[model samples]
Target: MIQVHAWADLDYDVLVRDMRAVAFDLDNTLASSKQPMSAAMTDRFAELTHRTTVAVITGGRYELVVSQVLDAIGGRADRSRMHLMPTGGSRYYRWHVDDDGCGRWKCVYAHDLSETDRRAAAASVETRARELGLWETRVWGERIEDRGSQLTFSALGQQAPETAKRSWDPDDKKKRMLVAAVSRDLPHLKVRSGGYTSIDISLPGMDKSFAVHELARVLGVEVGGIVFVGDRMNPGGNDYPAAEAGAYAVRVGSPDDTLRFLERLLVRL
Candidate 1:
């Protein structure tokens, strides 16, 4: 079963006591989807970095993380203490200091799908969408994106306004139908709903839990020593696997709620 916490009712001391690192989901947890991080969030995140290592695990591509998240944070946090796991942790990136002492991101490992697998997955998504009548629905931008290790199908288009995206699938009925169709058509790929707008399809064994284990090994820290904060920790949610991986998990409602939780956590730290 998943453990849920209301931001206002959380016990700060208990949650932060043994947490040596904190992991976050990027889109709605850290910032609005496809939007820049806020000034308050940037300052709070920089402060948190001083107390513990930080990692961002998201279904977004590496380029989006750079342009939307890192840029929004203004590069204030120490690169050495930060980790980025994009494509639902199928790709892991870390910072390395070059000869000039400037930091640069390097991919430590990536579970990229083979060319054949990518083509098959893409075809399955397209076919499934049409069969489900999803193609007839109104969309805002690109509906499908191939993020190296993962293929995502956003119902309202990736650039759809937040209001439209949220209203489009408040109950996730449309996306759920799409997921079932895609899963049936492509059993070899892992299909899961990501955030409010998209479904992510990745290779077998490439999920947030895989990323957590890899993060633990690379950082020389036990999985139990980490805390994962995300909005989607329910049974079918993408963040569910991280909780099952044995990290202490906290579920928040929105980016603002996450900020509040982080502020409380900082006080305890």
Candidate 2:
């Protein structure tokens, strides 16, 4: 079992005084479902950028995460203040602005999935899920999302209603149960939560925490010098990895909770 911690309850001031970078998760961490950031939230983030570097490490796809979301948050003073790590710690892409008022996406890293191996893995995962009574899988771009490394089994597939999905297993009861069953057999593979309704199984020893530490390395800072903000850090939760590694973590409810946390962070800066 992963030991859980309430990172917000730590001596947060010590981190603010020493840290040089702030990384966030996208979706519920920074963006709202149907509303853009309020003026106050954007202002607070801009000020935060001046005090420390900023990035958004998410689980969305690169093109969509960047073009649809990161691009919208671009008017900030420093464009380099942001980044997008999506595809379940599989990739990192930096955001840059062009002279013609356009944006550019430069790929920093991505795990190469060999087609031959990936195909074989996908089939194995799908057949297992089906035999276990799970439904069909959802695709993350060209790849099947078996959790992170392989196919996804949403209680209600990708086309399921949003209201239904958010309410289907709000506490993630199903995903956790799925992980337990899968782990019992595939002990060599890693299984964790994906988004809200699926299990992400990476090669043994990979998770969102791996991505957060990598971000710290790229910025030439210690894990102690970074802060990770996300809503779910419990075991099997996506943000659990960041919380486990000792990053100052802020758990938010609504996106407003995230920005409110940022408000306090700005005050410290």
| TM-score for each predicted model, relative to the true structure | 0.95, 0.77
lDDT tens string, model 2, 1-269?
A: 33332444545577578777887776566765323455666677667766778877666556546554545556664666665677666777776667897877777776644455455555655555666665445432232443233334444554454465566568877666667776665666666667665566556556668877888888888876677788676666788788777676667765677776776677777
Each prediction's total of clashing residue pairs, residues at least 3 apart in sequence or on different chains, is 0, 8
The TM-score of candidate 2 is: 0.77
Q: Cα lDDT of model 2 overall?
A: 0.64
Candidate 1, TM-score vs. the true structure? Answer: 0.95
Q: Scored by CA lDDT, what does every candidate get? A: 0.85, 0.64
What local lDDT score does residue 82 receive in model 1, on the 0 to 100 scale? 91
How well is each residue in 1-269 modelled by candidate 1, as lDDT tens digits?
Answer: 55656667877788777778999988889989888778888889888887789999998999988986778676678778899999999998988989998878999888888888778878888888787777746787888888888988887788888888778777878788888888887788888888787899899888888888888888898987778889888877888888889877788888999999998898888
